[model samples]
Target: MSHTTGADAKGHYFVPAASNYSTTLSIGIFLMALGLILKVNAMPEGAWAMPLGAAMIVYVLFGWFGEIIHENLNGSYTQWEDRSYRTGMVWFIFSEVMFFACFFGVLYYARRIALPELASYEEALNPYMGFTAAWPSSGPMGDPFTPMGPWGIPAINTLLLLTSGATLTWAHWGLIKGNRSHLIWGLALTVLLGAIFLGFQAYEYAHAYSELGLTLGAGIYGATFFILTGFHGMHVTLGTIMLIVILGRCMKGHFSEHNHFAFEAVAWYWHFVDVVWLILFVFVYWL
Candidate 1:
């Protein structure tokens, strides 16, 4: 009897079609080139240039993920392949951790050392100057660089993302218990909560730019603030896409209790996003 199942051939590990990987790589290179050109020179208004570049990158991801799903459904992966996947996911998460660490290090340096130096130098440059070095706050002695306020949408967004993390955990439990209905509902709620979080964040950004005068160019503080949060927003976008695809697969009965490495990988990624947000909430918002 043949051990092969789904779309897999006997004794063959399921792999994506060559064209899928080739096309994805080609699109990636093209997007990089286009982005470089856009960064270097002025482009036309509503130009097809930037949008086309983004579209190509999205196209590559969609096709690449589709191929992976096809392979998973075909039963081409064995135990060894599953182990390889887990290792790959661990490494990917590690790389993301390092990326965030670098940004946080910059924040620490600016807050602990550079800000004081700038303020002291301002005082020395003119002895009569009343400049004082302090962390930004919304009080009488608050630094000018302080955000207008922090009690509104940013706080709400923090709550939304934290709740979504809990909801996603519930969904993962449903998957483990083989409760497809519970799993679907949990995932739906998580995705909706995530979208709401992002929406609120957009509102907060608009308010900051318009009212608080906080922007990427405000200073080192503004630059670090945007870089950390911006990268996190990008991760949330990716995680939401992953959840949507997983939901689609669940509807099609593509995952079984014993074979769902793809789902596991997505779950890992979602959890990482949740953790990143927790750190951001503490350092970026509360601090």
Candidate 2:
């Protein structure tokens, strides 16, 4: 339970005593992944494993993060540790950028390369000679379905997210100026906007499935549309949860103008989510 002993005169970085948190978390992750694979394959034993794994992961994370927060509040972290955290967050966001980049790559290949190539060879294939390679195409065997337009729920959600980004920045300004009320109110508004965005997205998905016949099974266009938007919605959910946590901390006066890296880190993540959504709006929905 001992945290890093404050800064050493020898100038060595602080290394805390070992704990079993990582090992336990790894076991939980393994169980969760195995359960998912099994359940997808219709194995009965997976029913219990998935929830059990999820529970373990949640419990361990609460305990681990609680301990770190305590250590941070107790002044265990130094300039060196702060720098390391900044670098780690930078890399984490970079990895996320790459993750989405790969998905965008998939979308590009499907539309610009694969579909066009398929069109060129359609006559040669004979069976697919009737197929028309086009943007928002249902495959040759796919059912007729209306593609989603960009002007309705998607446009509203775009506005909501852009507004949330501005509100989050306002909260940062409040934090920097030591205005507790301003910070808390800004964060509260940001969380609300985020929740509203998600709700609208959920409704959009339901409409797609029920009315538009646009679904994962609807063909390649439907699959890519849902995949990109769905993942972005998940990220928004996570960002909203983080915003709520930061709001609680702000209420407790856990941060000062100078010591607010937790706030900054969450801000960085939220901004990344906003940027990604803009790209998605353009490529996946607008165009």
Candidate 3:
């Protein structure tokens, strides 16, 4: 005799369907809208407004991730879905790499070609007298741009973020080993380090603006410095929030060795941010 499993009255699987894809797409659209709105605003406080909107995006991501974890724990995902996720992550990282490459290219072109031509113009050339061209300098021409000192808080922040990267790797290793307590502790330490890095960055920005006269509108140097480092700071904020959500899920026992894609993705993002900051530190601040 052959046996058949009973389905629901509607002829569907007994389990409730997971809405992971719909939720992810909806949250992504909402975040994009918020970011665009903040970017187009002309208010005097628009700078702060952008960061506030970014925080809202992070809030949406946390909720959306919760749904994903719920679905995963409920056995809603299949092997094919897991493969799709990995492919999606690869493309996402590729896009981020391109994004940073654009900024770095602009920096290179400005310093190596555009600035020199502008400085040599007859009307502008005499402004700095006989000053020689050098990267990271002030006074509108070939003069060495006087950046705020590099060895103080900026250096300290470098150490903090680098250490956070190490701690996050430890957390990943703990997760792989199935050591729940160690994983939680490692994640907690990474978050704390990230917060400290942000705090020190705030202090350094204040000093740059108040004492060193390094405003975003100062010149090409200041503009590029702020744009590069500022965007990286925003990423750090997002990464920290991602870690907090992962920690919450860990506490709830949401992940397993074979199905921890969400945790691994965030860890990858955090490490990417860490590496970018290292380049920013050397090029924007120290050089």
Candidate 4:
């Protein structure tokens, strides 16, 4: 595949001729998502599918990333390739932004438009079903599940993420300045902060489920709460892993002052995740 003569004398951008990781990754993701959907919807027969998919993807991820990192370490990427990587990462982040935007939009529709209309029309017109115009709707069960506030663990998690962002920026600056020690320490701290943030989030989820009676079964409020924060937590986990990889590369003396697109891409993603959490904290938790 690499020997294929796709480019001619005309000015055309070069692309790697051999890569099959993308299709495999897509298949892994489809399996994971399908299994998750089935499991979340209470399909007992498919309970093990998500774990099976996750295990397969974990294996594939290790192999796939090993190949890419090996290529990067081998100095296979040129300036044009770096630019392509940047463009691709930007588009990927944009897609993630859209994904979170849809979830947030669902929250808005449920709280502002749908709930009010349901309460106004259904409560008055139907007279049999008791519907209320509430931000966290009681649904048919009328169980007033407690909503989490921004004061306690949520606030602490917010602080941790913000600090992680700052630490990441510090690491980037250290990289630009060619300070290996500073870079490694800053990145290590950032990963630590991210881990701590996830710890708090896990505790919060458990508290919500047991103490507050908030769960996936708690209707729209719980669903949005878990989905938004849960997704963000997953991103944090990915970002932490990315940072750990960067830390390892730093120790191996892999990245230079100018040639570190991988670090920059992960930093961009981590900052985006931080910003999303701030929005989540403000609207979902406090409001």
- TM-score winner: 2
Q: Compare the candidates by lDDT and give the number of the best one.
A: 2
Residue pairs clashing, model 1: 14-76
> Number of clashing residue pairs in every model?
1, 0, 5, 0
- Model 4 ranges with Cα > 4 A deviation: 1-19, 30-52, 122-124, 127-130, 140-142
How many residue-pair clashes does candidate 2 contain? 0
- Please write out the lDDT profile of model 3 over residues 146-265, one tens digit for every residue: 486679888998899899989888988888999898889999999999999988888878887887778876677787878887888899998999899899889989787777998998
**Reference-based lDDT, residue 55, model 1:** 73
Q: Is candidate 2 or candidate 4 better by TM-score?
A: 2
Candidate 2: what lDDT? 0.89
For each candidate in the order shown, give its overall lDDT on alpha carbons. 0.74, 0.89, 0.76, 0.84
Better of 3 and 4 by TM-score: 4
How do all the candidates rank in terms of lDDT, highest first?
A: 2, 4, 3, 1
Off-target runs (Cα >4 Å) in candidate 3 are: 1-63, 121-132, 138-145
For each candidate, what TM-score against the reference?
0.84, 0.95, 0.78, 0.87
Residues 1-287, candidate 2: write the lDDT tens digits. Answer: 53355565555556666778898899999999999999999998789889988998998988888887887888777888889999999999999999899899989998898877777774666567766678888776677789999898999999999999999999999999999888999999999999999999999999999999998887788888888998999999999999999999999889999999999999999999999999999998878
Model 2: lDDT of residue 164: 95
TM-score of 4: 0.87
- What C-alpha lDDT, on a 0 to 100 scale, does residue 170 get in candidate 3? 91
